[model samples]
Target: MSQFKPRRPATGAAIAVLAIALTACGGPGGSQDEGAATLTFGVQAPPNSLDPAQLHDGTQRYVWGSLYDTLIYSDNEGELQPAAAESWEYSEDARTLTLRLRDDMTFSDGDPVTSEAVRVTLERTRDTAGPQQNNLGAIESVDTPDEHTVVLNLSEPDPNLLVALAFGSGVIGDPDTIDDESTALNPVGSGPYVLNREETVDGSTYVLERRDDHWNADAYPFETVTVRAIQDRTALFNALLTGELDAGTVDETQAGQVERAGFTLQRVDGISVGQIVIADRAGEVVPALADVRVRQAINLAFDRQGIIDAIFLGLGQPTTQIFNTLSPAFVEELNGEYEYAPDRARELLAEAGYPDGFTLTMPANLFVQQVQPTITQALADIGITVEWEPVPAQQSGQTTNWGMYFNLGAVAPPSRTVALYFEESGSQNPFGTTDPELDGLLEDLAAETDPEAANGIYREINAFAVENAWSAPIFLQSTNWATRDGVEYVGTANALFDIRVFALSR
Candidate 1:
């Protein structure tokens, strides 16, 4: 979900505290009963579609996650765990993966959730070229020898396949319910909840009713769930105060205020990295940015700590590398390589033949604007002139436009993050900068089956990217959510609020 700037009054925090106090006394209302087992979540945006293949945003996943089940589970640290699949093993050559499905699992449509179903789902995912196609692109074929056995044949060894399956890649749908075109609007899966079409109003509110006979009933305890999309943060916050919502996504800046209001605060590192994406590396519009030294200078000029303290209210850590800190590939030594140094930045600029620096356009978002003054000052100290351009609302997440734009977005696994942004052949890489050196390293990293060897390759990739300044990472921003009294929501490390687990206090 995109950040929504709050227009709170000077006494808004105090008002919120008092309002929450009154809410405790008054009890629940606005469609919630006093002791009802319903969880109404005020989301930032509505689901784009019900189909898992079409889902690309967190808001959509928040709903779809409840309605679909993946083959594998992800622990908070992103380690692979068991879910639908009972156990899985790799072949001796590490080029094939075999999974054993739970014998008792069944889809919501009353069909057995078998290995054949898994194969059908994965093959369908690959053929559809869905949002998660990259996650399953390495699979050459899927063969089901029995009802409970599925073997995946890979074109090459793919270390990310398991992680991808644990994430968006392994959403299994009922083969009987899916159609070629209409599945985007209608979804059928073996998950715990079923979408209530009668009560659901597209673009405004979505209602999900729990299935009593679901195999994973222990995970989802809520009787009824309602997801209401409120774009304005102020309005969403007010709804929480007025007992209109049991939980809502809150900004990191409002963490203290939410806690002060007696609401339970949920914090996580989120799936996305916060950074300044140098989209125009080829320098079509901003010619000076084409230099590697200039990009390195830009990387060194940011006060990441200061920005986190001021804008994120000390809720985030200064990002060290492109990979999330939780990933095994993360190199601790690379954390301070681009430490804030105006002197070094100036030196790098001079080395790049820009002793007096050059002018470049920068796209500004709400959060980016908060730290713009400090960033602008640092750039000016290093003889770089920045022209701030307000991001067009329609083009919020598009990278086709030139300039240093804020990348407040999601990329699940570290390997996929590298592939998506850095690789020349990556579908998401708009600039298409060809780097055979980085490409060769990524190729090796992709094919490596040994975890330790993969980590080493990742370190080499990190060293090359840091030395070349592929992109200037700011920090991994924190995602904050707040729940009313008597509600428990365990936030995921990926920062996804899995609605399947949301439950009211007994």
Candidate 2:
């Protein structure tokens, strides 16, 4: 079991200092037009990237809510249901799959959603000349048989295709919506929400109205939703407390204040692994964190309870295993490998030739505040010295990308994320680290359409990651947000607010 050490609200003086900024931090919600229905929401930060090709990170994760929609989506159980493609068929050869587009869709600007658009969108996913091209490498080609129909031929059979489509990046935007270097300020897509207005001055915020003509309107609720970029947590909470907002994201630590103030709080198990990446492995130099035991020392030193307390105000639980535990394809044993033990952690560091300990830097942000400090202090108990090197939210420094620092990526399929982050040609692998075996495993797994076989590949990769210490995982962030009375809750694993089905009742 992992112990947690939560970061309490800094002391009396700190709270007093924070209290003054509380209103700026603690925002008050606002109301929409009397009869015009737009659900006003709050976001802690603005999105980072608008280009679908290079979109990765928390802000881009939310951009998914406005600018795109995927071929498939998940219901509460996470089973792939339907989206752009109304229905699909797998060829007898099992390598070719046909997708039937819903003819009832159109871009909010009134451009018809043609089968040609589907072709362009997919081909873009696999085009070397395009962004995210390698992410679609497993796909051999996309052939459109006719309007309303597209046949995707894979290099091999892949059962995870359906799941992959539900991924945020899998969202299909208008070929025109993408410009020469980035996504157009006005992106058009067949998604349920249409971006009517975007204010980019202080921070970018969008005003979205539900599309009554949405391909799936009957299932959607809100007709209009306004998403406000509230960068500070305290401001976000204040807005929620004052009923100035309907629903949005919040930190787990503020759960107590939210409860004390009398508001409804709902949460789902975190599905994303908030991880710490280690680079610069040249075989035998102990690569900063080359040893699994040393990595374990870090993981064990993480006071899960301490984080829950100090950071989360004791609001969430320590995730014992990888988020794979909730994945349908995960095997029980792989989730078992990432367990915690502090004494054993000491033993491992001692075995790794660091009996007296060594100094290391932890690149941090909000996620780091939640765990790294505690992990740093815990490692100190066993004599490990750590300095928190804050990585700015700018382009990664060349040296740091190759040697130090960790950048966050929202949770998606293991194959999808690994393909983007660790593969030889993948953009996130700034360190030039490449394992052909690991790459091949990704290929084999992606090609496996069978849930069982694909799952085996994920397990295999996790085993490899544990042994190699590719990155040290802290814990999945448990997503929780709230709404005042009469506002329905729609919590998603990704924390996106699906405006269509949301309803505000007085």
Candidate 3:
């Protein structure tokens, strides 16, 4: 497990004195009783809904992570570890998965966690029309052979099945209360913590108390876990400085301030990719986007390093592909495929029969407000005009009014990324964009069983996407987390934050 280390103080008598003073007070949050530790974590937003089906990634993970236990979980090293499920096995054909549960596990309400409960939760997540429903699309049916055994029958070989289960798709809840209206606010699970509904104020703060009788109590060391919704970056920074928050995320620009305040700054790189998605590839909304040269021109028009330096405060690395750097599909050479060249972009536009350039409409939302000016200026340099349409941040990505839009797509394994973005039924493929060659590659990847061979196919798909200029990816975004003196947080490479990753450093 990775541990946060204090940064060396800059050379200055006053600075050294302040660092010494902060260190003497046991860091920002002050000293705490190790035996009765309380971890107060702050997130940018509250969960949309407490229902497992309705819950999405990001802040929602901070909630569902404590309220429930997944069948399997990824450890600090990104390896799948047994959680509620003691062990799991795949069939020879890789089409069926068998899971064995720990008989000692029981829900907070004292109901035994049997195969029935697992089946119910998995089936509900699969059948529901929610964000994670498509993650389990490979499951054809769920079969319970015995009280402790559950079998998953897959329609095809899913290489990402285990990883998906380690995420939201594998969250197990009490079967009896799953459909109850109150369960949405009060969840009962066999996890290490139980929601303290009385102390939890919806949309503001959620309090979770430790369950001593939990099967794996050692995995979660906090006696109490409080997750607060502090959307404003300034407020979050203030809370961390004043010791109101034991741990919280901050913007890249504030890393120096946080480190100077005697807080351990943890960075997990390439968790997501900041990019412009050209959803309407058919040019149904923007006639100019239909040509391959036009898309290539857009890709070449952006100064990725300049954007990273200005907007991200030089905390990110420029990239030309959407795949995460840690993914097996990532090609090192692809990073330099599209260099910042406005002259080349203009040439491509002229070759595509639009020498005078064209007008492209994009959404204007608070989420992308910071980078809008830079984006507009970059495209303008290439003779393209941008018309921004004001829309609510929540409705911008869902609507088809704009031909292109800015988004931060979460980085996952190659297969999961493809299923979530490249597939016809994918969320990012809102217009059902399809390519016969890419479709063939995906089909082959699904049927392949060998890990090495599968990875080779993943690289091919990644290269194809970049070569075709399917989207204009700017850079691999980084996430920062600051923790107090006694709190040790193990960062996960993925986008979601797991509560189990925290431990009190007594």
| Candidate 2 lDDT | 0.59
Candidate 2 error regions (>4 Å): 1-35, 57-59, 92-94, 125-133, 157-160, 180-184, 198-202, 251-253, 256-262, 279-286, 329-347, 353-362, 380-389, 392-449, 492-497, 500-506
- Top-lDDT structure, candidate number: 3
Candidate with best TM-score: 3
Better model by lDDT: candidate 1 vs candidate 2: 1
lDDT of 3 at 499: 83
Instruction: Give the worst 10-residue stretch by lDDT in candidate 2.
Output: 1-10
TM-score of each: 0.80, 0.78, 0.88
Q: Judging by lDDT, tell me the better candidate of 1 and 3.
A: 3
Candidate 1 whole-model C-alpha lDDT, 0 to 1: 0.71
After superposition, the stretches of candidate 3 with alpha carbons farther than 4 Å from their true spots are 1-30, 359-366, 387-402, 492-496
lDDT of 3 at 283: 88
lDDT (10s digit) by residue, model 3, range 266-308: 7888877888888888888888888889999999998899888
Q: Of models 2 and 3, which has the larger lDDT?
A: 3
* Prediction RMSDs, each to the true structure: 9.4, 10.9, 7.7
**Candidate 1: lDDT of 336?**
80
The whole-model lDDT of each prediction reads: 0.71, 0.59, 0.80
Clashes of each: 0, 37, 0
